[model samples]
Target: MGTMEAPILTVNNLNKQFGSGCDQCSNPADRRLDKNYCPACGTVYSCQNITFDLHPGEVLGIVGESGSGKSTLMRCLYFDQEVTSGEAYLGPYKEGRSNLFRESSQQKRYIRNHLMGKVYQNPVLGLRMNFSSIGNIAEKMIAAGNRNVAAMEARGSELLERVHIPVYRMKEAPKNFSGGMQQRVQIAKALSNHPPILLLDEVTTGLDLSVQANVLDLIKHLQRELSISILLVSHDLGVIRMLANRTMVMLDGRVVEQGLTDQILEDPHHAYTQQLVHSLL
Candidate 1:
């Protein structure tokens, strides 16, 4: 919260589905097949309704058990999946203005290029295990229109050092690093350009408690230093409590409860929240 900035991303009433039976494709191989609705259930709300905002310099945590659509929501935001309805006004959706319910391919592309960064739950999914951390980060910078090899490598080394990974290891293959270290490399890659919005999906899921704590501290430090907004998706209530300013509890693809982190943690209103909190205690 060091600087004044507008909301970087907004999503309203977003809906997504796998197969609800609204459209049919004669040839499944066609990538340009038109989709009006669900193809299996013929329903509009095939998945669920989701509404959220990612403001500058804030951390919003989305928490739920497996299959509750947490990952689906992240995928939709990142354009890995499509939204059936609702508005997603990202970097360029509304002529660079704010539009909560509008999905603009142009805006999505702009955000992907200049405003958004994402880290997957498994670092291997985002990081190339076969390449060194320097190579992994350098590839992203090059893809983002940074052509100076020396400059890119310098920046990559800086990023790795910022994330607490020694710059010397930047030349080692990512597979040689431990899970926590690999996750740090993935973070360095995500931070290559310092995007305004960072989407993290279960970043500490497979790590030990000690490693998780270290990673969490690193993220908090970066968030404070960079003044970037974060959207965290996780199934662990403890992690959410530790990191999030606000918490959104999802169930069956829908948000069940959302409020201040302490409010929801101390006095959960939803049964789902209660269940999650009790399990953690």
Candidate 2:
């Protein structure tokens, strides 16, 4: 669904370094084979000057090995972690004028509630296991200003049904469900606000292969049905190929390549990307 139209989300020159940009970090020579780590000063540029755009209804994939900075980038976008330096403008929020990283805490909360929804790699991170399944979804609705309990319950049930969760099981605790069912519940919570942008970080990471396929199918179905812009982070090339229209390959805190998913899979220009592509062959 990518288009030449203005992006729904824009991130320019994003950087997330652990240290204070020490003198050794500034020196290109001190940057070890691991691009993020410095030998002399031990500075870690967890995410190094990343940049990308996510258009309305587009599915953008960030693929990399674990700890390659893709997850760090996702964390920064979700405001779970602060960025070291960068400008992020959500077009559907604040009229795309203010940089998200610079907004006040209250303003950030508003933006999060109104403009974005996120599903973390772990269901525990995204869901309240102690709460009932519908109760978990209700929390997101409550944050978005919904006050009527009946309406929230109805809405939660609808979302649960959409995700293939049984309506009768809506009152059960997520901790009692299978991993796949728990993931579906988490997805329902993320969709509670009907946001224009959704951030998914390795949503299927720890599931079994069959469960992963089913969840991936649900994700594809949601993307088509909702037509929302998606920023998907995953280490699996198969997952990326299955869900992404455009793909960005990250390595050692840097985006080494970006293009259409097929283009990158068929002909990866970067050596790391080539190796990644071949491994799945």
Per-model C-alpha lDDT, please? Answer: 0.80, 0.90
**Most TM-score-accurate candidate:** 2
TM-score of each: 0.86, 0.96
Model 2 agreement with the true structure over 1-281: per-residue lDDT tens digits: 42778999999989898876566577545555356687777778888779999999999999999879998998898889999889999887768888999999888888788788899988898899999999999999999899999999899999999999998899999999999999999888988989999899999988999999999999999999999889999999999999999999999899999999999999999999999999999
Backbone collisions counted per model? 12, 0
- Candidate 1's C-alpha runs over 4 A off are 1-6, 22-47, 91-109
Model 1, span 1-281: residue lDDT tens: 43355556777788776654333432224412223233444443323668876777889999998878888888878877778777766643445466533546765565665567789998867889999889999887876788999998889989999998886778999899999999999998988876878899999999999999999999999998998889999999888988898899998677999998899999999998998888988
Query: Which ten-residue region of model 2 has the weakest summed lDDT?
Result: 27-36
Candidate 2, position 196, lDDT:
92
User: Could you report the Cα RMSD, in angstroms, for every candidate shown?
Assistant: 6.1, 1.4
